[model samples]
Target: MSPASSHTHRPPALAGLELLASAVVLVDADGTISYANAAAENLLESSLKALSRQKLAAQFLNPEELDNICAQARLHKFSDLRQDLTLERAGRDPLHVHSIVSVLDEPAGHVLIELREHLQHIKLDREERILDQSQVNKELIRNLAHEIKNPLGGIRGAAQLLEMELPPLHLGQLREYTQVIIKEADRLQTLVDRLLAPHRRPHIVGDVNIHEVCERVRSLILAEFPAGLTILRDYDASIPEFRGDKEQLIQTVLNIAHNAAQALSARIEAGEAQLTFKTRVARQVTLAKVRYGLALDLHIIDNGPGISPQIRDRIFYPLVSGREGGSGLGLTLAQTFVQQHMGVIECESRPGYTDFRILLPLP
Candidate 1:
């Protein structure tokens, strides 16, 4: 080695930069966290002893992900940009962090890194708004439906009673009028029930296995439409049980799947209809003005005729449907239930395949 090169050291001005910096983690090649800037300790919610020398992967969202990062660091020494990373910080919400790793010029095995918060928080603000809109819609339907219930019941009863009293000639005519009122009332009742179901019930949060939820939805859909479609499971078993209302989750997932099934009817007959339920862990997800260190990532993918350009943008809006016979409330209800659990759902649809991503915060 050249004499001047071997003697090079961290410039005096740069020595104290890391010591007083605002980054979350600092580590060496053995994956030991040798130093954590004050901001890092605060973000992780622990002190030096609890964090020092611990394997960086131990506190990460997925340990294997850290391994991948380390591998990247080893391969590309001058590549200063670290891709966004999610971390499961103890006693704090999941953090969506963007990071950078660079080779340390002096300390041979040292890698200097810095991280910043990412895209999870802004999403929660949108969810809060959706919840408000759903509540208003539910109240309007329930109150209005009640008004129709009383008068319609009286009209049907009076018609039947009159038919019994009047001579046989006019009895049939009165019965027909009553039948009209009864049919109309029943239809109105069904409409009211659909509107009120989501808001009328209390959320039952518990330890729910996401895979079971997927399996149940799969069975129900296949039973209803078996031949033309394929339902595949791509699950990450390490995903832990999260606190969620099982029935609500079932309906939430079911509505999306049902829509995909309908869209794929033609593809199914052609032996190309495909639906996949994929699960993984998302770290540092921000939803509903909150962050979780770990979140459930569920993807519902389908191969179909794709949504029409006209109504595609409004699919989740109440009363918007591309189908002639559809109520258009399925996706709306799905969005409400997911928002109740502080989850965010987004959709991407094109000519052949559509993807719905559900990100639920891990408990």
Candidate 2:
């Protein structure tokens, strides 16, 4: 549907304080847009003149979610409400927006809704907490590894030594058991190293072409799985090189792409998998009260089964995985690396498509 002209609208001052502070819109229980604030107008890409009398549920929200919002508004005059929702503009990666519903009683049936982007705050807060916890987790792992590692080596060595003395048939069985112990010990040591790498390393910042990072990850993912999967590219060539650590940038994209690929496994097997790497330039975006004005947008999108609703909010938390039999640290680590680069990552998912969008400042 086409939007109306942007010229007609009420003054910004009358749009309520909540609208001033947040991206919000007013809609009747039938989902028609009665009013929209400046922020909401921008997000919806339609001015007030165009938005008035438009159905909110059919136009923007998924049917089920729209019904739920309407139910809440109909049920009470005032109620505390919170929901995780997504907004995809112009066929783009879905923007992960957290919504808070507050009702307004007036002649025109309306529901006062506010939306806050989750990427900024969570990226900053979660990263700080994870970094600290990683340090503590590292120390405990190092101390434990050292104590058990020495004995583990001796145990494996003794088993090997005894195996050489035994007959061939019995030797093979004992040798296999010893190998298990060696393998497990090696895995523990590897985990400890990962915990320490981010803390011990110095960030090497330089003029980094965001596209280069996407290309590199694209090549790596294709090399690993060259069949039954498609890697689509949608990039804004105008994006400038940003100051970032090359290695870290690569890791961040890799971590996110790897997770998407895992989630797309079934689709890949069916020859219907798709993974897109896209970049754009977002203007005048405010994050954490500071307006960077211009930000680089990178998106990792896929068509697969969506993330489970259960862990959606905590998806970025350490060791939280949407897929079964997954380590879950990929996104946690990706978030950490992006935070180090002073970037933000937002996510949205449904049954068929899932999007992870990363925003970084331009150099």
Which model scores highest in lDDT?
A: 1
Error of 1 at 206 (Å): 2.4
Q: State the TM-score for model 2.
A: 0.62
Candidate 2: where are CA atoms >4 Å away?
A: 1-170, 288-290
Alpha-carbon error at 292 in model 2, in Å? Answer: 1.5
TM-score of each: 0.66, 0.62
* 76-178: candidate 1 lDDT, tens digit per residue: 6456656777889543357777777765644556566676667524544556666666677667766876787677678767756765787777877677776
lDDT of 2 by residue, 208-312 (tens): 998889999999999998998899999889898878898898999999898888888898999999999988776545543355757887888999888899998
What stretches of model 1 exceed 4 Å from their correct place? Answer: 1-129, 142-167
Instruction: In angstroms, give how far residue 208 of model 1 lies from its true place.
Output: 0.5
What pairs collide in candidate 2?
31-56, 284-293
Q: What is each predicted model's overall lDDT from 0 to 1?
A: 0.75, 0.73
